[model samples]
Target: MKITVDRDACISSGICALDAPTLFDQDDEGVVLLRTDRPAAEDEQLARDAALACPASVITVTEVE
Candidate 1:
């Protein structure tokens, strides 16, 4: 899966980091930090979960064909 984050829209909720540490993280200011845009197959679910869990809806997950 491919993941993307809107830094401008992030609210520093850290939900993405909390849900998927490998795919996401929080910066020093608590902004959403994308650890990887492309996640491994095993981490597909985690990426999706992080996107869905983002309170500001800043995280986006796209299925790779």
Candidate 2:
């Protein structure tokens, strides 16, 4: 899967980090930072959860063939 974060739409709620620390993080300014856009198979669920947990709905996960 491929993860994308809309920096302008991020509210800095940190939900993504809470749901998947390994895949997401916050920048010094508290913006969402993508640790890995291409997550491993094992982390797919967490990545999805993080995207859903985002209150701003800025996180997007796209299936990669």
lDDT of 2 by residue, 1-65 (tens): 89999998889999888889999999988899999999999999999998788889999999989
Off by over 4 Å in 1: none
Q: What overall lDDT, based on C-alpha atoms, would model 1 receive against the true structure?
A: 0.85
Model 1 lDDT tens row, 1-65 = 77888999899988778788888888899998888899989999888777777788998888878
Model 1 vs truth, CA RMSD: 0.8
Give me the candidate number with maximum TM-score.
2
Please report the candidate that would top lDDT against the real structure.
2
Cα lDDT, all candidates: 0.85, 0.91
- Once model 1 is optimally superposed onto the true structure by TM-score, how far is the C-alpha of residue 17 displaced, in angstroms? 0.7
